[model samples]
Target: MKISRLEAGFNYAVLSLFTISALLPLVGVVLSALTPRAEATGGLAIPSSLAWSNFKAAWAEGHFTVYMRSSVIVTVAVVALTVALASAAGYGFARLDFPGSTPLFFLLLIGLMLPAEAFIIPLYYNLRGMGLTNTYWGLIAPQVAQSLAFGTFWMRNNFKQFPTSIIEAARLDGASEWRLMWQVALPALRPAVLTMCLLLGMWTWNEFLIPLVMVTDESLRTAPLGMAFFQGRRSTDYALLAAGGMIVAAPVVIAYAFAQKHFVRGMLGGASR
Candidate 1:
């Protein structure tokens, strides 16, 4: 059914207002980042000249190159591990009927409710005992575990919508379980997989708590954690801090821009079922 002209106009007006509200802060950040040190703190005024040096200063002072490298390694590893394990677990839960399946799935769902603050202390000590502290594994392992519950839930929802008849037909044709999952079902779950990857990458990229607690070595600090320390030292330097924030936020924004179509499709597909 078509909406009335009044409803359509009202919806557009509301959306436009929300869009402007969201964009104003970002525009302020851009302005602040480009403003000279003295003018940046003065609020959202156009600067006399673009302080292009703020980004360079932020990069150099923040040691963002090292932090970015660490972030990339951790984010890629977490997303890869999460997708691999979550897909298998999700497919199993969605398609199979083993003993204790429901109970186990519910147990896994408990992880979704648990907060990082609740487990970070014990997790830190546990990683230290395992000799993983201050290493990439220390950061990666917990994030993978943290991501798995939701990944499993997301993938399970995607897979559960597959037709049982098609699965049975593939099995009858001598397709092994692995073949069925990877070759048949997984291809159809591409949108969901991409969406999960995007979401997990964003979460891992922005994560500060896990890295802060588990990593004491300066070199292993991820972007967000590094930016936090950078801000602490340069708290008075608004231009530099804003520039640092932009640097940390840019990659995720670029990635989301590219994958937004698949992301939207995946979300709508899941919700429709």
Candidate 2:
């Protein structure tokens, strides 16, 4: 059904208004970052001269080189492990039948409903007992477990909706289950997988509370956690605080830009199904 011209115009107008509302803070942050410290009045205003040095100052003061390195290591490891394990689990849940499968899957879903705060204290003690605290593994392990529930849910739905004809044809050709899953089914699910990766990467990258409670090693802080500390020290310096915020946010923004096509496609496809 074609929309009326007036309806189309109204839709466009609403979207534009929402888009601008979302972007205003980002635009303000950018302007604040560029404004020289002396000229910054803790409010949005165009800078007379770009204070590019603020980024440099924030970088050094925040020791973001170390923080970013830690964030990358944790995020990459968590996403890779979560995706791989979740894909296998999702495939099994979607395609296989076995004893306790239904009950086990329901148990797994409990992870999704629980908030991080619910178990963080107990989780810290458990990790500490295992000598994992204040280490990269401490940070990486919890995030992986936390992500797996949603990751499994996401992939299981996608896999369930996969075309059965292709699976049957592969089986007729004497393909093993592993071959069918890794070679045939996964390729068709690339968009969904990429979408999961982009989301998990962002979550892992921006995780602050997990890092805060899991590790006290200054060298082990992630970008967001580091930015928190950076903010505390630079509370009075609006320009530097804005610059530091951008530094922490830049990676997620860049990743989303690159993967937006796959992300949008995956979301739309999921919605359609």
Candidate 3:
């Protein structure tokens, strides 16, 4: 009994060490953001005075409000498209049967394993052909495509775990295919939906690569790309950059904080099944 207790205690100590290690940088950023702009380069120590004005300065200098709008529009659109398309594709792969369905699904699943960087050039030209470069549609369309690969893969696995008995019973009760999927199978997918929503939302929200590559207009920048410009302009000020980091991370932190429980449950359910 003593040995088991000691082992458990040691494991907890390791876990605590890891947890603190992960959080220290975030804490430092927050502290730096709250300090005066002049102290941005004043090393890692806490400043003598707290300066709430740093947040305002980051906001103004970064043009965060405009970038935020662009970010929201892109994120929301991508999430919605990813979920809708992935849910349908996932359900189809798991439940429906037709010619070439398996092969087509395999092609999509293969895409999930492929690196997105491999497609950057092709994607760029494709966007240019669509005449969508430097626009919101160009920004969102590609993100949706990149994210859909994983989304479909995620939902496909989840749907596979659901018993077909219920679906068959619904079919016998005069339910159409759409009705069975929408009213029955989908309701049981809450955990998966939550998991996917959280995943896609985070990815799309924090995305910089696609936006940076596809968009060039200063007015159309997403938050992270906009922050790069902000940094260039305020390159001498480390405090403002730290504050900008805080601002960028705050919404994600708040969202995860609220949805944490469901997020964990969803991940476990999908993985365990």
The sequence of per-residue lDDT tens digits that candidate 2 reaches over residues 1-273 is: 999999999999999999999999999999999999999877879999999999999899989999999999999999999999999999999888889988999999999999899999999999999999999999999999999999999999998989888889999999988888799888889989999999999999988899999989999999999999988888989999999999999999999999999999888774232
lDDT of candidates 1 onward, in order: 0.93, 0.92, 0.85
Query: What does candidate 1's lDDT look like per residue over 169-268, in tens digits?
Result: 9999999888888998888778889999999999999999999999999999999999999999998899999899999999999999999999998887
Best by lDDT: 1
Candidate 3, lDDT over the whole model:
0.85
Q: What is the clash tally of candidate 2? A: 0
Residue lDDT tens for model 3, 155-202: 888888877788889999999977877788878878779878988989
Estimated TM-score for each candidate: 0.96, 0.96, 0.94
> Which consecutive 10 residues in model 3 have the weakest lDDT in total?
264-273
Q: Please list the residue runs of candidate 3 whose C-alpha ends up more than 4 Å from where it truly belongs after superposition.
A: 1-3, 270-273
- Those runs of model 2 whose alpha carbons end farther than 4 Å from true positions after fitting are 270-273
